[model samples]
Target: MSAVTDRTEAGAGAAATAGAPVMTRRLRVILLLLLGAQFMLAADFSILNVALPDIGKGLGFSLGNLQWVTTAFSLAAAGFTLLFGRVADLFGRRRLFLIGMALLTAASLVGGVAESPGILLAGRVAQGLATAMVTPAALSLLTTSFPEGPLRDRALGLNGAMLSAGFITGAVLGGVLTDLLSWRWAFFINLPVGVTVLVLAMTVLKESRAERTAKLDVPGAVTVSAGLLALVYGITAAQSDGWGSVGTLLPLLLGIALLVAFYVIELRAAEPLASVRVLKRRTVRWGNLGGLITFTMGSGVTFLMTLYLQKVLGFSPLVTGLSFGLLGVAAFVGGALAPRLIGRFGGPKALVGGLLVQGAASFLLAGIGGGSKSWLILVLAGTAVSGFGHISAVVSYMVTGTSGLPDGEQGLATGLTTLTQLVGLTLGIPVLSSIVTARTTALQATHSAADSVLAGVRLALLVNGGVLLVGALAIALFFARGTARRSATA
Candidate 1:
């Protein structure tokens, strides 16, 4: 695929981009396959949220074990992503991508036909692992395919938009399919898409790998995967088990221990799965930090709003999904504009502005409770603004994180990018919900149930906004300033 372009009139910047990768007609096809994989994986994260009730009902899951429907997927994703990133470098990106897609196809089929909770959970875990394998390879391929310039930024922007759209669509599509057809269709839908991506990818893509790859770091991979899995599980457990309980604290502590061991192992290993040197770069470090905040706050608002709409406002699953779909549209718009914004304002400036927008929106939402349908305007507006902020930050931070890596390291770099995002999203729920629960308890002691929920939501929104604002400032001061200019030139 030739990515070369004719841009004589695009100004001096155009000439500067001439040396970047060129795409022929096949370039578009390659991009579609890559972005399609991205959309599929991202959608899987939220698609099942709406289908969970139906799935649980059909499978006869107990309340205690029910959450595994989602958690199993999360655990596999968080745990295996980094390992698979390194694997892509050592093996081959295209090979891994195709394998991952095939895995996803099989997983979807298994999930769709599952007659038992165990089978369904197994399918979800397989899907998560498959996603972990695919994401890094796809990101590596996309980033390497388009060299750094307007093209790369635009590509990343579009990729971000597709990701946002898929996430938003999943929330809505799950309900629509579940209500009209069956929850099994949620899994079935993935089957065709996954297979198509795999087939097209086979035809449209060439194999790629590190020019000088080394042996895989088995210990580092195992320790890190186990460490992340344990930690993520602990973070999730904290929501239901209480942050201070043994169920939460024990695995958390163990996870901490394993992670410490992993770091130690990496420092000594000749070829670490994830290079400590690359991670030490300021952009990589801060980008992940900023990404963590953006993703956490952005996903946090959606999670809270979903609760408010369903529990407080008594919206049906379909209505709730459709309501959030508006946010998705806004997100795509923001994503489309991210390239121009980054080009004009630079990544750091854009990152700051985006975070600020999200913070302000969260603050505005604090007082927006009480299930009155009249409040829909405020809800939609707040969510729309927040979604814009999120997509903007998402693109900016991804560029920041992956910039300057050699081709061989791109997989590891993107793996880290994905790891931070998934972790942030995974953690957002427990952290924000905990605050809301506490406030709701305090309010319920004295106020009407509806009033208490409203009060609780208001307080939670305040905390969410405050934290985002703080995170924004931290990113601005610590990560954004000098790199923006350099990346622009790059």
Candidate 2:
């Protein structure tokens, strides 16, 4: 913000007050550290999928409860993110970021060394909450550090690229590590990375705190966290427990009840943690909805294909992971090109283009049939195209969602985006899984096992494609339409 006169006056540091926009080597270093934190968190999300089998054996996790090894992390992360994001706004971003890193590092150490399932589960829970803190704090820091312009767009694009790269690497790296080294390395791997991020973040990142402080509403935090936890947990469990089962219905109902209570509490609380007023912004609402839709469609298709590759085609874990390698490359290219796309056509148009591309990719893949020699090409091209669309859509949303927020609310804005992303992922897995189950069950009496599974995969792909197309149309009609009407007015 060195060239931004208003920000220069508002900020105190030499870095902010410089006149020549301070596009220095040092600022680039800061950007890398912030993005590294993003990669760290993203890697953890996929790193354990291949390692879960080994983790189960090593820790004696029963098959019934073994899935929680992964679920626990997501559950805790989604639960506390809103509260911690607002807490960072109220307290200090940098302070909370460093603390989160420290906690995550410690949790990693505990999980890495754990000899018992209980201990590992506990570590995962802490790691999840720590991730909650770091994600929003780090993102808000990046948003606030760079002025909202080409520079910030470039930074956000780069951040999105690293995030995509991390997911690919994590999926592949986990299989490699588990085959060659040990599953424990999956948890231990974050040790050095987390520490380095924490240390570098202290140096390159400047402290930014809200100008005004509000009292933390403890009751609201508790209700909201518990509510979100139950909601996410219920959705996740729906795949295994059956949506109509008592186990699933109970938590889901409780989650809804608590969430409603949280709304009431927030309305009545003195100095509410987060005001519903932020939703008044058109960009926030549309950007978040767009995010939720794209992520759900992307992850849903990927999950279905993974099951198809492993179950029907009998592909090894390593091969399945390597198959996604092209996606990372395509995502990097898209991320590099996104800023230019936004500059030319604007964020809303870029968003519309992205969703269309993703929808087309999903549709193309939906046509792949069993025993076709063309399956390989279909998987590669579909994933590559989706990669381009996914990164572009994500980067555009990041820019559009946080575009106009004041510095004081950056944390909250980022928090909502992160929250939507997790919720989308949490719900996507089960939603797609349930669809596949129902379709596969229906075909079992009429078809072979492999054919049933293949048919189910195709059906899931169609559903994913249909959803993405609907989302694209929504973006075109609502958000992108505003862009066109504004251009006409101008």
**Best of the candidates, TM-score:** 1
Residue-by-residue lDDT tens digits, candidate 1, 82-161: 99988998899999998989999999999999999989999999999998999989999998887776788888898888
Off by over 4 Å in 2: 1-22, 372-374, 480-490
Candidate 2 global TM-score: 0.93
Clashing pairs in 2: none
TM-score for each model: 0.94, 0.93
lDDT of 1 at 445: 72
All candidates' lDDT scores? 0.87, 0.86
How many clashes show up per model? 7, 0
Candidate 2: tens digits of C-alpha lDDT, residues 17-39: 56424555666788989889899
Candidate 1 worst ten-residue window by lDDT: 1-10
